[model samples]
Target chain A: MEPVLTALSAGTSVDVLIAALFGSAFGLVFGAIPGLTFTMALALVLPITFALQPTAAIAMLLSTYIGGASGGTVAAILIGVPGTPSSAASVADGHALTRAGKASLTIATATIVSTLGGLFSLVIMLFAVNLLAQVALSFGPAEIFALVIFGMSTICGLAERSMVRGMIGGALGLMAMTIGQDPIDGVPRMTFGSVQLLQGIDLLVAMIGLFAIPQVVETLAGHRAGHQMKIDTSSIKVQLPTLRFLFSYRWNILRSSLLGTIVGAIPGTGGPIAAFLAYSQEKRLAKHPETWGKGDMGGVIAPETANNAVTGGAMIPMLGLGIPGDPATAIILGGFLIHGIQPGPLLFTERPDVIYTVYFLFALSYVLVTILQLLGVRLFVQALRVPHQILALIISVMCVVGSFSIRNSFFDVGAMIVIGFFGYVLQKCRIPLTPILLGLVLGPTMEREFRTAMIMSEGSLSIFSQSPTALVFFGFALLIVAFHVVGSIRSRSAGEARPA
Target chain B: MTTPALRDRWTGLVILLVAIAWIIGSEYVIPSGYSGSAFGPRTFPTGLGILLAILAVVLIAGTFRRRDTLPPPAPSDAVDEPAKVSTRDEMWGAAATFGFLIIYFVAMQVLGFMLATVLLVATFNYFVLGSRSLVTTGAVALGLGVGVWYLMGHLLGVYLPTGMLGLGV
Candidate 1:
């Protein structure tokens, strides 16, 4: 109780509030733009947080995350293009409603439902994270090794179109991390006698490159033909849904939020998966399923609610287990590390105040995002009018500035360009980037734990199997890999059998 | 090469070579010494390299099996595929962007953050974005360069590089 009060005070400081507001506004703008994703926004915002108090920095990041997650509905509703992938499910019904002349109503309902969903998931996260951390507190080196392997396996299996490609991506990330000094031995592994290489690849620099540069290149290339759609925003205004209307779909909102939270809690599954699952479930359960692709408010509510709910759901694993479920949370994990806040089971015992502060700020971000979105819907809508090429150019400059600001190293900026080019090539090959990021985030921990477990057992492999907890996690990892392998084989055989 | 199967095969082959190179590098290039622990520093990288090699082989074998059953699609047939941008234009755009970034990086050292940023922004606006209006372009370039310098340098206390020119915040 005392911790909660202390957290409340810290989270509500004037600087923190202002940072939250700024982050939310920035996220909303970036999220509303079709090419400029919130992931890119988070990457850019990360450097700025270096100067802020930990509480204020976290507040800014959390609000940005929440706002970015929710802000996708604007473009999805108004212009038939989803600002982010999570809002792809929102577009069918959202744009349909816009075409039916209820744009304002759709936006309002999405905003309200997004807030409700975020808050709902925050409550679940608040309870579940603490409980999960308590369970994780018993984890030893072997258990942690097994658990991280399981987490990595799931990400590699599910993050991309091809499981093999995803694994390759993960391996590439792991390989990249091996370039620096060895963690335990302090022996340089692959630095090649360069002083700069001793620090290894900065995760933030890689993230900025991976997420931002491709978007910039794609935008520049694609915008040559000028595919910008002129949206009619003359009649758009915040039209709040009636209490009766919202109450009617209360069950749908609850179920979608629940689904979102569950999907988010999983290691690799994220907003798009959750939003789509919620959408399909709602469509299946609807009284009139045929109206779904048309202008059904339930469709918008389910996906919007679920996607926003992912913000909180993702935090569970990130804060409790030190496992970031997706790219955004991976960056957030980076933020937490930068603040000298090492997440995991120890965080619960060591810094309960920080945990509570996160919770309070997360909930507060929802309120603030809702207000900002409600008042600035028109502003966000106008942002969509900005040309993709210009936006790409701006983001290009930001990428330079953001990377340079990190450690003020020119080499880091050059490294970003190289990694970004590599990332672009990987994208062209249809290799998923998230698994790579997951590998990067988890690589050092995985190595340290594995080595520690080995030493504890004096090079005996049975140490991993001796612990039931470790065995269970290893079994889960094997099961996930086997499942993916079987699924891929079945898909291939089915594809072969089909008449071409 | 445009076909997914063919592309995968090429990618797999490249990755296979990389894996082999990584394994050799880890064994030869990385200094092997008597570490206190049983597992040495080179162990993880070597293991990862082997795993990558196996995965690359699997990927290549999958592509071969697919090729045996169906003819690879022609390049023209890929035109209708969604999300497949114009490769030529994309490559050119990427090259141009990279060139510009390199110039900016070099310029930053000589001209400092503010001037280098202005040049970079102006170049991007005119060349990349195709913005024709001089007033709009100049204003945006100056505004962004000055704005970021002020916000990041003066307000946030981030150390923006003041290079040989020393015209920074």
Candidate 2:
């Protein structure tokens, strides 16, 4: 009780509160801008945070990190652009609602669910940090490899036409990841002496190219607005979701929040992966599974909720152990070090004040951003009312700016253009983008872990079975594949039996 | 692709070739010596290449056996299948958009962000939107091009190419 009182009092200072507010708004802009990342947001702000008090400094970092993750939904829902990679899945259903004239409802649902999910993860992280940290550390190289495979199984759920196409997309992404220096060895496999190729294709370039650039082309083709009655979006009220309506999905919120926290705490996984995993789980559990990917409301809520929840979940590892959670949290970890605070097990006992400050700021930041999103929903939806020609023009330019800002290299911008064309072709072919993205994000990690395990076991396969964690995750991967196959067979037979 | 089945078949064959190329590429990987060597670098990519090849075969087989569904519906329309097929205007519209995108990429580097955006937006509205009003098109082009440049360069302190104008921002 003494420690709690002291920490709360310290966290309530004007400097700390003001810093939290500024961080939230600032990070919102960073997240809402397509191609700008949270890590960049943290690094950009670190210079000024040097002089502030320790608690205030840490508060700003936490708020910015939380705000950036939640703010991605605005662009994704309104303009069909993922403002941050974390919200890529949101584009699947949120944009559908936008085209259907239900943009306000979709934004409202996302805000309410995201806040609850974030708060839920914060509570678990605060109370169960110790136990979760142990489980996270136990994941060795083989276990990490198996986990990536289990994540790859999600390509099944994301497959639009069939799983085989999804595998091809996934494999292509993994192959693309092989273009730079090898993760295990320093080997440069696919670089063709351009020097730029040695650093590999930037994930940000690939994401912007795959997700946003295609929309520009579609808008030009008159595909942005579908054949639905145009509703007057300017005057619509952005109502807060009714409690009864939200309470109905209590199980989904709880389950996804838990999954988000677990995955985020595991060190290597980020919000996009968590968001997709949660989406797949919800789709599998839903009564009307067929409606997924066609603008289903659950698809919007599940991914948004899980991604926001990851803010706190990702923080657990960075704070409990010395390990950084995701890229954003890694930058925040740097912020901690700059403020002369070391974050590990000892820091919890030594500086309880700084730890509690992070918790309070996280809770406060989500509430602040959610309220901002709710209040500004009407303005955000105005994006849909803009002319297609103008919107496409703006988006294409922003895509250029986004890719350019990542490394300040002309080569990356050029790569984005080329990838945009590739994405355009794939979209025409109906090959789902999610599986390819999954492979890109997870591929390097998968290769590194697989090789490390093999070398440790002297290229023997028995290493996978020796570790209980590795064995379990591999088993889970096999189960997912088996279930996907069975489900496909049953659906096929049912379709064939119908009278033609 | 005009048809989904035909498209998937092509996609599968292209992927198979890419997988084979990837295996050949793996053999050339030379470690930079900054990191410790574990297993052979080719091991992982080779394994993935084989898996990819198998998946490509499966995708082609499935495409050959599956029924042909109707063309995908446009996002904005309600009618399941409109009588009007892909017309010449839509084809030209798509091509113009692609051309404009490439032009913008080059223009931004050569003419700078602000000027290039203005040029790109002007050309895009005239060609893609087919907007006839010069005043509206000019105003929007200038406004968006200049406005975004100001936000990204001045307000956010993010970089945008200055090109020839040397606008400082």
Candidate 3:
């Protein structure tokens, strides 16, 4: 109780408040623009957080995440295209309402439902994260190793269309992490006698490269000049839904929010999946399913709620188990590390104040995002008018600047470009990038835990099997892999049986 | 080569070769200092190399089986899929974007962040984006270059390289 009060005070400090506002505004703009994801925004903001206090920095990141999650609805309503992948489901009903001249009502309902969903998930996260951390506190080195392997397997299994490609991506990430000094022995592994290589790849630099560069190149290559979207701004006002109207769909809202939080808590699934699931469930349950694609308010509410709820749902694993479920949460994990806040079971025991501070800021961000989206809907709609080519050029400069600012190293900037090109090539090959990112973030921990467990047993492989906890995790990993393999084989055989 | 099977086969072959080379490097090139444990520094990399090899082989094998079982995609389907950059102009646009970045990196070392950024932005806008308004391009380039330099380098206390020209603060 005392820590919660202290954290409340810290969260409401002028500096933290300003940071939250700035981050929320920035994220809203970026999220409202097609092809500009909040992941990219988070990557750019990471270096700037170096100069801030930990609380303020985290406040900024939390607000940005929430703001970005909610801001995608604007493009879905105004442009007939989703600004982010999570909002893809929102476009069907959102644009339908816009064309039907009820844009104001849809936007307002989306904003309110998004806030409700975010807050609902935050409550779930507040309790669930602590409980999960308490349960994880009993885990030993072997258990942790097994758990991380399970996380890796799930990500590799679910992130790509092809499981083999995903595994290859994960292997590539692990291989990249092996370039620096050995963690336990302090012996250089693959530095090749270069002083810079001794520190290994900087996570921030690689993230900036992997997220920003591909978008820049694709935008530059694909953008048609002088293209402009004409939107009717006068009709796009926020009209608050009546309580009676919201009460009618209360069960839909609750169910979608719960579904989103659960999907977010999983290690591999993320916003788009959760949003689509919620939308489909709502459609299936509706008596008049025909009204779904043609401007039903429930359609906008279900997906918007679920996608925004993902922010809090994702935080559960990130803060409790040190596992990020998606790219955005992964970058948030990087932010937490940058501030010297190591997440996991120990974080709750050692820094309850920080955890409470995160909760407060997360709840606060929802209020701010709702207010900002309500007031500045027109301003954000105007932002979509900016040409993609110009935006790409600006991002190119930002990539160089952001990379260099990390350690003030020119070499890091060059490394970002190289890794970015490699990322682009991987994208061209249809290899998923998220698994590679997860592998990089989880590599050092996996290697360290595996080595420690080995030493504890004097190199006996049975150490992993001795612990029931470790065995459970390992069994889960195998089950996940087998499930994916069976599913893939069945799908292939089904496809083969069809007449061409 | 444009077919998914053909592309996967090529990608798998390349990855397989790279994985084999990585295994050799892990065994021969990486120094395994005695950590007084059975598992050495080279163990993880070697394991990753082997995993990559197995995955790459599976990928290649899957592509072959796919080729045998599946009919080819219709020409219309192939053409209808959005190309990343198929036109000549778009190809040049992609190449020029990369070329400009390489130039910016070199120029940042020689002329510093401000001048190099201005040059990169203005040239990219005029040449690649086909922006004809010199005044708008100049203003945007100068504003972005100077504004970012001031905000990041001066206000935020982040270091911006002054380079040989010594232009940045």
Candidate 4:
């Protein structure tokens, strides 16, 4: 409180605030656009922040991060296309509401609930950073590896098609991660002579190519406006959820928030999985579970809240442990490098100013997004009215430029074109790309930690099982697998009992 | 791919053969030296090859173990058999995009970023959107090509290529 007050009294610069607002608005627009994710938005904005004051820079980036994560709900609700993977579950009920002509209500509810949830976690995250930092300092490679295993176990929970297929997908991702250099040895194993291959596959290139490019192709090819997606201006009201409803489902929301926070605290798990798990939990707990996929307000709120909360939750590990929470935070970590501020446990002691600025940024995201919600709902919906032809053309160009811009090399553009085509093929074959993205993001880190831990312990499996924290996480992973196995068997048997 | 178990088995065999080729390429072609010596770069890819082979075997066995759900009969036979009709056009479009991309890659090196990106985006857009307006097409092509050039070159400070005229600056 004292630090925040000091910073506030240091002078409230309108310039910084306006810059933050602009960044947030851009993030909002990018986020609402299908295929441009929070991470991509952050990466695009990161290099640009090289020329701003540290406070303004951090503030703008943080606001954009929050805005982008929350903004995905708009596309998810209206077009049945999740703008970001975090908002995928939102499409279930969100699009249903749109089909039922309550698109405005759904969007408003998502925006407001997202803000509240973000603010809630932001406050807690700010106050508890010290304590969380203390806990994070205790984690080592074994604990980290266990956490990765737990994250990988989420494939069982998230696989919509079949558990076996999901495991296969995750295994394939693990294999893909193994394609680069061996972490301990620094041995370049996978690169087949091409200088570009030695640096290993860039996950950003893979992600954009996989998620963004395919969507461009699909939209261009299908080119169908399924229904007239109209937002009733008057219906855009953020009604407070009923007291009775809150009391009834308080436990679930709290649990989901905690789930999101914990996952966020473990760097690289990110928001999509958090939101998916929350929605799954909500569905499992609902009195009428059938209402979930159709159009349940609770379904919309649960994941929205959990996903937004992830912004603050992710910061916990990033600021405390110097580990990035996702591709977005990885870029933010790069921002810290530009500012000559090394982010780790010492960052708090060395530069409380930057830390305070980060806190202020979180608060400002709430303010900016809430205001944007009030003002720009109509404008945003109208922008979505752009014809598919123009949008596809624009996005494809952006994809090419974005890939090339990453490195001065034309090789990256070539990589993007290749990966984009691969993604298209994968989509046609019904292979999901999210797991592949997960592989690219977490793969290298997981392999390094696993191998280093193994070599340190002289190839002993006990290292993964010995530590209490490791053992606990390992147990949780097994429990998740067991639960899914039982659930699938039960569902299959029930299906067998019923008439076809 | 739309064939019976035997056909699917053959497809899996082909995929397995391709996986083997990829493994060989990674092992023989990739330079082994970087930092560590005892366990070099080729270890993981080699291991992955083994794993893939094992998995392929399992897949083959699984294919054989499963009871084949053959299409029952025509609709006139009192049962509406599940239609296995493939969306071949979508598949071909996807393949064509891949082919186009290969051409774009070659063209990028020769024709440069501006021309190649414009042509690629315009051509892909035409095929995908089927937008026939020449004026609209030209505008889109220019908009995309120049927009990318300005954004990457000026705004982001990314150094893209300047082929032939050397006009990237």
lDDT of 1 by residue, A412-482 (tens): 99999999999989888887888888888889999989998888888888998789999998899899889
Error of 4 at A479 (Å): 3.8
Which stretches of candidate 1 lie above 4 Å from their native place? B67-84
In terms of DockQ, the best-performing candidate is: 1
Superposed model 4: Cα runs more than 4 Å off: A1-23, A30-65, A72-110, A127-133, A155-163, A177-183, A224-307, A310-359, A458-466, A482-500, B1-43, B52-86, B92-108, B115-128, B132-135, B167-169
User: lDDT of model 2 at residue A187?
Assistant: 60
Kindly give the stretch of ten consecutive residues in candidate 1 chain B with the minimal lDDT sum: B66-75
What lDDT score goes with residue A42 in model 3? 87
Model 4, A1-500: lDDT tens per residue? 67767566432587678768867886887788765576666655654465566776677788788888888888888778787889988898988988887776678767877876787777678766777566755767787778667766664344434444444445555566665555665656556556777677765566557656776665544353222234333444444445675566566667767777766666436788889988998888888998888988778888888888888887876677565656577566656765777666667766676677778777877788778865787666565666654765576656665666666566877888878876676555444555555555556656666666766777677887778988987898889778877886677678557655
lDDT of 2: 0.73
Give the whole-model CA lDDT for all candidates, comma-separated.
Answer: 0.88, 0.73, 0.86, 0.67
Worst 10 residues of 1 chain A by lDDT: A220-229
lDDT of 1 at A314: 93
Those runs of model 3 whose alpha carbons end farther than 4 Å from true positions after fitting are A224-234, B68-72, B75-90
Query: What digit string (tens of lDDT, one per residue) describes model 4 on residues B22-80?
Result: 67876786567554433345655666566556655655664565444554334586444
Candidate 1 global lDDT: 0.88
Among the numbered candidates, top lDDT falls to: 1
Q: List the residue pairs that clash in candidate 2.
A: A187-B31, A225-B76, A226-B75, A226-B76, A226-B77, A227-B76, A227-B77
Share of reference contacts found in each model: 0.58, 0.54, 0.53, 0.31
* Residue B111, candidate 3: alpha-carbon lDDT: 86
